[model samples]
Target chain A: MARQVAQRDDLLPVLAETFREHGYEGASLSLIATATGLGKGSLYHFFPGGKAEMVEAVLAEIEAWFEARVFAPLRQDDDPAAAIAQMFGTVTDYFRSGRRVCLVGALSLSDARDRFGQALRRYFALWVEALTEALTRVGHPPEGATALSEDIVGGIQGAVVLARALDRPETFERILVCLRERARAA
Target chain B: MARQVAQRDDLLPVLAETFREHGYEGASLSLIATATGLGKGSLYHFFPGGKAEMVEAVLAEIEAWFEARVFAPLRQDDDPAAAIAQMFGTVTDYFRSGRRVCLVGALSLSDARDRFGQALRRYFALWVEALTEALTRVGHPPEGATALSEDIVGGIQGAVVLARALDRPETFERILVCLRERARAA
Candidate 1:
């Protein structure tokens, strides 16, 4: 049972990538099974609730990632600049240098919008709050920090879209630089 | 004959919305045909090369929009800020306050990345160049302006992604504010 649990954890990342590449509506069960090297029966065994449950798990995983790689560092750090820079590094790494499309962008606009909408909103809200705290520590006033942090969250997402479309990492990199610039400004 | 041409022109907006909502790969011919209220035969009749040609026409329509609304005004006006603000107004109206998804974002990471890459790149490049020129005229150094303009394009695209996912217009509105800030900074 432990071994099976371990294998299922391994499959989650694969499934995440598959969903990222193809939105929930587009990522058929057959495609998920093929990508994970698991037959439909095996996939069902791992995700008994099927695709919807699998998607919720993936979103949960992403939220956990932000907690570990982003908010944790920001909350624990004294240097907001370093914290923000490290967060961007984490972001750049996660998106695979802009090659992997953001599932949030796709699924939010997909037919599942109503179902996944609140979770998506929560994801952005959490990121903005963490970043806002960091910005506030860097001497920005409360209002400006909140607002700027919101822009940063949206801006990073926007950069990912552009970088993906242009098939380049420069835009993503430049935006990261802008994020780092905020830290330097302090 | 003229009536048919006019009817096809009317279909462009509907097709554009469908493509914008569902990326190239996801926007199946049947969905598009249904959206346009046309049968497959009629869709093919309008677009002989089918979806690819339809996408090309949509991109072309976007290009014409830039010429009339963005490029034409920037080229004609001396005040870069006014020109840019007007352009943002046009964009705000077009994207329906950030409810619409961008096709470039959908297609770039799509399977048709290779087939439609050039046109997508051109779409961004032209927008960047136009903004760069406007910035240059307002005293932004040429090199810095080009880079910033590119960032703006990517940033706006990213903001749209966030706004769509969160189902909020504020993020999109904020990014446009940032764009306006740059214009004013010059």
Candidate 2:
């Protein structure tokens, strides 16, 4: 039998998915290893800090994704509205049309909250900061822009819960539409 | 020494808090027992089905809370807006001003989702249904009312996440206001 070595980058999304599907505490290392078709030892090789490190890596990856797809486009010199529209489409696809839940939200619970609280807080803060900047660029008042930015991110998280609960993909879509309306409100 | 016997009703909230503070997987019998100042054996006496039963009990309690405060009031003929407003106030207090996370959202992840998925989904659906009925009475279109109600519930869940992550109680308050606006929309 040939042994396959997994790269660190390849393991992050798998770990994120595991965390999303199972709350952070529920997703055991063995479960993650099984998901990736890798051994627990191999997972350790990639994440030296164990589950904690794996969580940080997954969160960082998610942040990077948002930065590239959503925040960056919002700052482009082209039509801000157009950029936001495209970003919304990508968000829908990334969340699998809102069928998937947020790993960040799941991991933020319980002991995981104590372990990853600062990073989680920073992640949300950065989102609000990034979105606020973009909204300001589009002529929204700073205070309202900041508030709306927070609401948009928070609202999307809520949409994930509702989507799953109701078994409706359209609920997630409606949230994005509401977000777009706020972005364009200014 | 006087022994304090905890009632089943008292134990439910403590267990709910344990689950909230720690994900369901992490909130062991020992921890839950400690929270209520009861022995592990005593916990079992109250919850014969073990962790699963405890979860069912907690969920049942939450449902009862909503039935009494939100749904029932919505169905009342006199001023649904007034009832909803009162319900919102109770909800605000129930969440401790957003300093708390949703046990439903936490438990709905991974395996617990499989165990309690239907219950969780039904809980959310029931909220949407009740809100839709009230909104229609207040003159909102049925479809729009349904969609908005889902958003309001989902948005609150997400807001809980954001508030925890951001360490901002105001974030939760802001979400309530957004919900209020949607509720009042005709």
Q: TM-score of A-chain in each prediction?
A: 0.91, 0.89
What is the per-residue lDDT of model 2 for residues B26-108, given as tens digits with 9 covering 90 to 100?
88888887888888777788888999999999999988888888888887648988877886788788887778777877665
Cα misplacement distance, residue A93 of candidate 2 (Å): 1.0
Q: Can you tell me the DockQ of model 2?
A: 0.69
Best by lDDT: 2
- Per-residue lDDT tens digits of candidate 2, residues A13-66? 888888888767778888988898988778888778888888888889998887
Output the number of the DockQ-best candidate: 2
**In candidate 1, which residue ranges exceed 4 Å CA deviation?**
A1-6, A109-111, B1-6, B75-79
**For model 2 chain B, where is the 10-residue window of minimal lDDT?**
B105-114
Q: Tens digits of per-residue lDDT for model 1 on A119-173? A: 7887887887888888888788887887688677877777776776677787778
- For model 2, what is the alpha-carbon lDDT of residue B83? 76
Clashes of each: 1, 2
Tell me the native contact fraction for each prediction.
Answer: 0.60, 0.71
TM-scores of the candidates are 0.90, 0.93
